[model samples]
Target: MVRGIRGAITVINNEEQEIIKATERLIKEIIILNQVAPENVAHIIITVTEDLNATFPAKALRSFEGWTYVPVMCSREIPVPKSLPKCIRVMLTVNTSSAQADIKHVYLEDAIHLRPDLQLTDRHL
Candidate 1:
């Protein structure tokens, strides 16, 4: 069955390097935690806060081997008041045998506050 893995990370700044590095880190962590293979990934959708316009998060994935062929899209997140700043989020649609409750969702840096209930412990991954 196809499952969706969610991940988000907060960037310190809107700099291109910062955005790229944070995005790569978030994606890598999600992949590692979920044991997601590129072949099993149907597509990825990334969103960034309005404050983050330095670069598209999907651009960072292109640098990884085997990710070039993966379908990726980037967009701006809904600008809610008092929302987290400089945040980048991703939803990876992947084919996995695991049940929905068994999937690992990654929330890094300050983004961890966004999903306290679903947040992972150190040993979870």
Candidate 2:
């Protein structure tokens, strides 16, 4: 079976360093919570607000301890009025047999408020 993990993080600013840090933190947490293997990760699609194009969030994964070849891409999130600013969201598709109830979804920092029903696991950052 295949499962999808969704997560998001808020950037303190539009700075490259902040985006990279936040993105790395979110991806690491998602991977850990799901016990995801690099090979099992089909691909990761990420979206950032238009205000955040200075850096690609996928680069953060490249700097991860043992993840250097994971396929990652970035795009602009749908712009809407009164939406969260400096937000980067990711949808990860991975091969797994686990049921939805056994899967973990992460919403960090301000993003936590996005999914109040999902319990948070320990954060890697």
Instruction: Report lDDT (CA) for all predictions.
Output: 0.91, 0.86
Q: How many angstroms is residue 33 displaced in model 2 relative to the true structure, after the best TM-score fit?
A: 0.9
What is candidate 1's TM-score against the reference?
A: 0.95
Question: Model 2: what TM-score?
Answer: 0.92
Error of 1 at 10 (Å): 0.3
Q: What's each prediction's TM-score?
A: 0.95, 0.92
lDDT string, candidate 2, 1-125, tens digits: 98899999898789889999999888888888888988898889999988898898888887776566778889998899888888999999999988988888888878887787885656665
Candidate 1 total steric clashes = 0
lDDT of 1 by residue, 37-93 (tens): 899999999999999998887888978898878999999999999999989999999
Best by TM-score: 1
C-alpha RMSD of candidate 2: 1.5
